[model samples]
Target: MTSKEKIISFPHMGNYYIAIEFLIKHTLNMKILTPPPITKKTLELGSKYSPDFVCVPFKYNLGNYIEALEKGANFLVQAGGGCRFGYYGEIQEQILRDLGYDFEFISILNAEDMNPFSVYGIFKKLNQKLSFTKFTYYFALTLKIAEIIDKIEEYIRENIGFEVKEGSFEQLQKDFLNRLKTVKGFRDIDKIYKKYNILFRNIEINKPKNPIKVGVVGELYVVMEPFSNYFIEKELAKKGIQITRFITVTYLFKNHPKEKELIKFSGKYLKYAIGADGTDSVARTKQLAEAGYDGVIHVKPFGCTPEVNAMPMLQNISNDYKMPVLYFSFDSQTSETGIKTRLEAFYDMLLMKREKQKWKKVI
Candidate 1:
């Protein structure tokens, strides 16, 4: 609200804020307010204002916008476009207006059209002090940082389950992400990521050469946001299951080029994109089955039409390949205890199946 100070805010989606914060700071020199980490309170706020049947991501994001507005953020950013999210910005803006909040709502919904110059234009319009040359430099660095963070996270997912010391990998991940926030440029990013990658590798773990691997396939938001999925990955890891997921912050930067391969792989099941990550889900589940993974876990929000459409195809894949698949649809009202019990049953089944396979090979 102050004449000289402008605060821009966006919803939380894992550690993605770290790179976003670096970009806004180094390029536009604007103050950034991050919505609080998603919690039970956040879900409640979002659910109360949102349509009862909207996907879970909508409620969570609406809650984020409300809380950010309450905390004095004048500019709200909604950076999603795939699926119904493309239409959510205007709807959320209207809802907030109805509630009497006066502010600017910015949408970067057309992610495919985004480029360095377009991004520079957005910030330059907000503040004339943003230099095109400086923005270019920082933009490239910001992308590298995003990719590095994703890579480090993937490493952590693969190893965290078997750490010799409890919280060892987690503590390293925490330190690394916090340090990432203070890094000024590419050199700092490279140095910090390398140091942490080394530390993560050196951390003692008792992983079997071939471990139970579960590939997570779903709508990107539900798969990537821990709150939305009830921290399923952490629970699976605690049971010593290695996890693989294709969605990440960097997937946006790459424009999901892997989608071409996904189409080819899923052609027998689905010939065209069903929207969002539907095709990718089918393709990834098939890929995991072919690659000898123990199982596949599909996570999506309730009323997710694309994922719903893909479910039949996934069931076909499950039947043909004899690959075990677990499907989870989450909303604000989803019960944590129910999810925990179901996961336990699935893990037990997979363990027994593996043991049977081993016995058959020996016989």
Candidate 2:
């Protein structure tokens, strides 16, 4: 069977699918099928086949694979990372094979470790005629695309709450993402980003002098994928809270601080890199607290060991600074209603705290 006829797909994790698709299409010689968007059906399907206690992301990925496979995706890819995440590809591959699906998978583990020769070998296996130079170009372009998107998103998170016209930020963001799908090279990515940057700035806003500011720090997947966390950031924004999140592909691939740096940034609250994104969560929360942000929300999938490990340290920091920290754990069985209710209460409490501070100043 000729491999050129195969279709490639990877699990969706937010608007980053455009970057993933751009890389695969430009570098590899196979057709790409963007997985169906995550939905209730996707979660249910993923949960059904997944191990009873596995983290929810694992189930979501499996569900994405099944949906893609059903749509004729014979080639699959999974990202690699630290903690339980690094081993996900092998286990998912095993489970899929046992379920009788025939497909190819590559777990491109860890961005730091994917050197030129390793990348060349991986791509060469799929397309023997692959040009290392060409692949390298597109790969760099892919990283650039991801970096640009991360900056745009950080801006959106900060300003999305204060837009004078509802959905202006969101609608502009949607258009920008659609434009990303058609990018051909570095020039295209730069043009799209520049265009959107101006447009995003021009959107009118009525931000208060002291808006309720919140920083989000958590497990990588939950922080990056809005759906995974019940769109917690969106809910916060809907309450007119200015949101800031430092985690993104740019942080992971381009600007991730070293272990020692993470410890230093986190202050005495953390002395060790707590594995995966755990240390960064602690550090970013500390930074947010010191920066006078109103609160922090830390999210993770149920049973995620790294984020769980960081919780005590987070609480310590929260206590030290009197900063409020909200925690949410997601699972296949997590309730939408419970999440919304807790979020509403959290927003109200933050508002109350800010009002109380003002009254004390008045006296």
Candidate 3:
């Protein structure tokens, strides 16, 4: 079939879809069928069709697939990972097939299969016209885009809460993403990032000498997908809470430490890799506690075993260092009100704790 006849779609994970879509359109030259931005209906559609015990990411993916298929997507893609996520494509494909959908599914996953060379192989099969040199150039550009996005966002999370003009940081970020949509080459992305880096730093802020800081660590999917976690970072930013989170598309691709490095970084709290992103969660929480952050927030889908395995280590690290830890488990039925209430209380407690520390130094 012609590239135009093969419309491709993948699930959304925050703004990273911009980068994913960039790579696909340039390499495969296929029609991109971006799923509708996720909403309550997407969650409901996914939940109704999903098995009772699967993780929430599975439900969300299933939902995205159904929506895309209904909208004339003949080609769908899902990424595989170390956890139950590795089986997502197989099961989700079967479920959609049984539902009477006609489509082809692809799992773009594997340690050996993610880099430009392997990815080029995957695309070459779909688009015979794709050349090695051209594919590599665009792939590199895509990674650069993802890296710049994460770096700017890290700055935004740290200062968006303190912007003198509300929404200035967010508006600039929106502008940057819009600019990214128009990028044609490496130089284009570099110029856009440099322009925005200065624009972001120029935005005024009223940050305190010692601001309340919190580190967020969690399951990979929930940590990256805002809708799944009910926009937790945005809600916290509203309280002027400077945030730090270690997981991003950038980190997964470029900075994810080796297993040995992660265990060593975790110190006495962990001796082995728990599973998937869980080990990274424990290690990062310890790093945050040692750095004297006010607290750490751990978010995961309900019944995620790897994260469940990391909790005991997290608690021990919390106790030994006297750092507070807030945990959140997400599912289709999770209560938004409860999340807000807990976050409010968590912010309050962090404020009180910071005050107590200040008083101790005074004496």
What lDDT score goes with residue 171 in model 1? 88
lDDT of each: 0.87, 0.88, 0.91
Shift in Å, residue 58, candidate 1: 1.1
Model 2 lDDT tens row, 1-363: 235488999998888998888878877889999998999888998898888988998888999999999898998898666778777788889998889888888877455456667877888888888899988888888888898889899889989999999999988988998888888877888899899999999999999998999999998888898888999999999999899988898888678888899999988898778888899999999999999999999999998889999999999999999999999999999999999999989988898999999999999
Query: Candidate 3: worst 10 consecutive residues by lDDT?
Result: 1-10
Global CA lDDT computed for model 1: 0.87
For candidate 3, lDDT tens digit of each residue in 196-230?
99999999999998888999999998999999999
Q: Report the C-alpha displacement of residue 40, candidate 1, in angstroms.
A: 0.6
Distance (Å) between predicted and true CA of 193, model 3?
A: 0.7
Question: Higher-lDDT candidate among 1 and 2?
Answer: 2
Q: In candidate 3, which residue ranges exceed 4 Å CA deviation? A: 1-4
Could you estimate the TM-score for every candidate? Answer: 0.96, 0.97, 0.97
